[model samples]
Target chain A: MRTFSAVYCEWFKLDEKRYLDEVKRSANSHSPFIYPTMELLNENLDNFINHQEETVISFSQLTQYLVMKLAHENELKVLLDGQGADELLVGYDYMTGYYLNQQLRSLNLKSFFEELLTVIKRKNVEGLQLLSYHFSPNFLRKKILYRNKKYLSNRLNNIISQDNFYLSPMYKSKSLTTALIVNVDYKLEKLLR
Target chain B: MTFGIETRVPFLDFRLVVYLLSLPDEYKYKKGTTKRILRDALNEYLPELVKQRKDKIGFASPDFKLLKELDEKHWS
Candidate 1:
């Protein structure tokens, strides 16, 4: 992962593994393979859950929370995060789907094919998956993916099946501009919180 | 949010975001490259390796391996 490699790019007195381990530990005390016991993991999970006051299956926020905790411990009272660039600039790899869809809708064959070939060469199957997801209906896609165990916990899938919960403004976006705007209004807003 | 630290995001400034949003799509992504303008604008300040790097990993931890090693009972 680029994050792991970025750690290696820095000057370090310790060996690579040790340096990474230290970095991970600083970000999250219960980072896997760094701590010797599960007690810290359980304790941190409970602490995170209580502090967040919401149900979240994803632990990505916990990693960030722990990083802030580290900052707090070091007496750092303010931090500047590079968080909104991806949503604003459409910098994420999966975002190719939105861009490609826009190009196809506008009948920009040259741009579409050019980008498609590059994505196929670089990302292979993952690029194809992004394209399929963009073209598919939101509910149908979630149903198929959940049935195939591609994502979502079984309990959450059951809840989804029972409710009308699949609608998102993002699926209706007809251009990359609209998609970026939606992401900023919805996804990035959550992250910035 | 409860760590008593104030977090700021300069990129999310309304003025900057509005400006970026107004740009054409190709300005953000071209061919296979993402963040086209950012890379181009920061080309001089960024190292060659960073400028050329395609892969980006954002605030991600090794959660899959950790969950695999964790006991199933932990979830219950």
Candidate 2:
């Protein structure tokens, strides 16, 4: 059920992304609705679309926000997006980091871990997932997720299982799969549901 | 709604580049690649579960296959 919702959500999300790219527009498209709330929603959408027009964020306002975050609310919800930070951050898949560590064995593992940490701290959950993969290179030998099986729950695991990881039943085993199902109580049903 | 803007990218610093390049290849690109330093830096926070990531996977949504069955049973 969760996977189904995520899929259904993702398809529309992807379709929206494509439709936006084709139109070079932001969310909500150009639809006008009769409800006042819908009209306000449209206007807010327009604000975001307009903001995309000015991609650069200058330092003057940045310092203000930084100072504000520093001062208030234990900085719990401080969203840390910055301008053109991608030049420094790779923001690539975690497997890339794993491949890099494997391929570039000569580098100082300590310092490399530093750079990866900075990125993980800055991004969202997907970033966290990749960070997980980077830590355990040998774990991918089996289709089964490791102990605890939290993020790699059956739904997320099954989505990833669609790939040809060449994972064996050994190593982690279906025990991991079964544990995830018992804990989460969700699995992808066949089309016959 | 009120909005504010700010920008500074220490990453783009010319001095940072020169400083990075000044490091030995053993430190800069240990196996002869860029970003070789990140692995060591992030090793601690790196999740153990992900260390098993040997393959690249794309996300496909939950069993919409059930949708086909639902159609067959109800909407068909």
Candidate 3:
């Protein structure tokens, strides 16, 4: 049984050249379940697109489909998916900004600073760059939407550009909890289907 | 859920979900660590490396070149 580790190496191996060589060696040795993974994707692209009755957002979804198909071929009757963990547990990196915003909003400066420092150290980013987003959730949300405008259809852009456009209930909220609620209400529903 | 296989999501259990939601936000994410409570709760049971892992790959492929090729092929 080929596990996840057998398929994919860790994100950051210490030696880059050695890691690439090892990956090439393993790819040659394993040959995988149905050719190489990506080639399988290319071969099955038409079937995959037909299989989906709705829109596809990310390549992760495609990979997940491939995994489920592989599991089925392996005769696995049931699979456990960790889907709701991120929404329930505030697991996304962007949620850190919401958490910091909550801390600052609630007059929890000590906690805010503590979390801010940890984020800075872990991500190696300047703290000041994060402040505008952390302090103003509305601004951050608008900025995000504006940045994503190119990806949106003209109809979507026009709709969102309206001053009275109704955002979700959580729009005004800076709390991570509220953000998670919005994710559950909107994002998780799609994934559930 | 596809390919005649059933998918179960334990984390979406109503009781557990509600319990997590009711807790303070900081408990869920603190000190740059998301899922802090889960990591702590499973500390005794989970391997040290898993509990300490900061990256959340979530079964996504790491091969960007392959993905780029696929994207180009699909769009083109």
Best by DockQ: 1
Q: For every model in order, what is the number of clashing pairs?
A: 0, 30, 0
On lDDT, the leading prediction is 1
Where is the poorest 10-residue window by lDDT in model 2 chain B?
A: B52-61
Residue-level lDDT tens digits of model 1 in A1-193? 1121212122322114444454454445433322212445666887888898976544466756666766676667777778889888877776777777778889999988998888887764444555676678765665433342224577775776544233346645667788788778776647668
Number of the candidate with higher TM-score, 2 or 3? 3
| Candidate 3 docking quality: incorrect, acceptable, medium or high | acceptable
| Order of models, best DockQ first | 1, 3, 2
Give me the TM-scores for chain A across all models, comma-separated: 0.67, 0.26, 0.66
Candidate 2 DockQ category? incorrect
Error in Å for residue B76 of model 3: 6.8
Q: Please name the candidate that would achieve the greatest TM-score relative to the true structure.
A: 1
lDDT of 1 at B9: 88
lDDT of 2 by residue, B1-76 (tens): 1233222345435565445434443442322133445545655643433322222223222223333444465555
Give per-model TM-scores: 0.75, 0.26, 0.73
